[model samples]
Target chain A: MTSSFTRLLVMVQKELLELVRSLKLLWVPLVFVLLGVMQPASMYYMPLILEKAGNITEGAVIEIPQPLGSEVLAQTLQQFGTLGLLVLVLVGMSSVSGERNSGAASLILVKPIAVFSFTASKWTALLLLAWGSLSAGYLASWYYTGLLFGDVQASKVLGSLLVFGLWLSFAMTLTLFFSTLLRSSAAAAFSTLGTAAALSLLAGLLPKKLGWLPGSLSSFAYQTAVSDIANVSLFGWALACTFTLMAAALTGASWLLRRSSAID
Target chain B: MYDNFDFGQILPIIAPILTIQLVLVIIALVMCIKAEQTRGPKWMWVLIILFVNLIGPITFFIFGRRNER
Candidate 1:
């Protein structure tokens, strides 16, 4: 376990380099930032654009507030929770498979790096990148909302940001694990995305609360921003995040073991 | 989000995060450069990955990692 931990650290460092060097890294954050910013800006300005259209017939007009802090959080999260998370999954799917394809995995393994460590490092790096992108999107949304809706305060959105960040990180872990199992990045990405979609669907179908599931964070975040729903304590969120991250790492380890035994 | 780089509020949060990201990204970039791949494949791959970002890496990873000798 200790050796695996060290390997995991090294894996994280190595995988991080591949992520930063690539074009996806640039676009992933840029897209998320754009998504987060667009949500509030679009919401805040929609009413004005609607009024200008004068398309409403003799009926009550709906007015959208100049983005409340809650609304900003809601809008940003609505898109980020879906699109941003998907992008993160896509980014993560390449963590192990990319190196393996490039023959980098073999090189790393040849250098006293255990396969599990290589897997762990990739998972960590991917999750870290995903977390960073999520934060950036959160930041952008906060700023855009602050400018568009002057009534609400920053403190209002903090809970939502934190929870969503943890959720995104957890999702990244799953993606990395699946990437290791799959023979191709495309397959891994599709599988992860499909799993995410399925999880969301499952959450929707299950009338009861599925704590720590895909949509819970978004729900928790949105509620904290709008209602008096107390912001979830960091402990629960941290535990879930760590659980999912570890799950991904362990799943990958099992896959490595399976492959090694199969080869033998 | 608070104020364009609100030193008091946002900096504390973002500073550590940014520092970690910079270090990680630098390392990831180095690993990518040093990594070996098949001749025709690596160059083609570099172009694809550079442009496609996550999509390319995911694709190459699942499908291409084994083809290299």
Candidate 2:
């Protein structure tokens, strides 16, 4: 058991090194920070931007009520839900399948490392990146929101971050699972994004019925930020479902990878 | 519209966005220069990373590299 733990640690280290070498560790979080900052900044400056770009007649009033700080932060999460999710999926889509397709997996699998360790390590590294980027972005958004608008409660910000981070973990885990199952990275990315879109769409369409779905985590995060969550039971269910799905996906990826490694 | 707005107030707010963008572009350029195998022509990626605003560097980071080695 100690040896296995050490192996897992080694695998995680290798994954982190690769991420750094590829500059993903630097760029992904930076992108998130940019996305986070842009939301509140643009919203704060909307009037000025519109005045400059729209070329309205002088003295033409464009009186738009300022959004609450929490609402602005919620909007930032919305941006993260869409474009931020896409970037993460794209970055992680090639985690396993790319190595396999390029024959790197065969090289590594011929050694003594366990396949479960390999998959678990990849999952861990991806989680680190996802959580790190999400936190940086969320914190930036919170700071900017406070600066530009008004103070949001620390509990609300932290609560929303945890909820949204779980949703992102679900997305990243799905990408990893698909990457292990499929040979093509593009297919893995497309399928993962498609599934996320469908899940969110379904939850949005039938919030009363599908509130427990993992897709509703984004909504939960947004609502938690803007005000008190409307349904505590539903949020709890969604949290449970997200954790279950993430674990299931990781396990599925490990099994698939073990089979594939054996075949190779 | 132009006279009433305080440049001092606005610059501080927008400065971080521009700084982050500049950092992204610089990092992308450095990586592009150092990368041995890009998905397409290196010169074209340089163009994209330089000209495409916020998305260009992200695009290069995601799709431009072959991800080998």
The candidate that wins on TM-score is: 2
lDDT of 1 at B38: 36
**Top-lDDT candidate index:** 2
**lDDT computed for candidate 1:** 0.62
Please give the TM-score of chain B in predicted model 1.
Answer: 0.44
Candidate 1 C-alpha lDDT tens digits along A18-119: 666554566567667666766766575476557656588755567554545676677678788777776677556666666677766666666766656656
Among incorrect, acceptable, medium and high, the docking class of model 2 is medium
The DockQ scores of all candidates, in the order shown, are 0.06, 0.71
Model 2 Cα displacement at A249 (Å)?
1.1
lDDT of 2 at A38: 95
TM-score of chain A of each: 0.80, 0.97
Chain B TM-score, all predictions listed = 0.44, 0.90
Task: Estimate every model's Cα lDDT from 0 to 1.
Answer: 0.62, 0.92
- Relative to the real complex, the DockQ score for model 2 comes to 0.71
Candidate 1 runs further than 4 Å off: A1-10, A23-25, A51-67, A151-153, A207-209, A212-215, A228-245, A248-251, A254-264, B1-69
Give the runs in model 2 whose Cα sits over 4 Å from its true position: A55-59, A262-264, B1-3
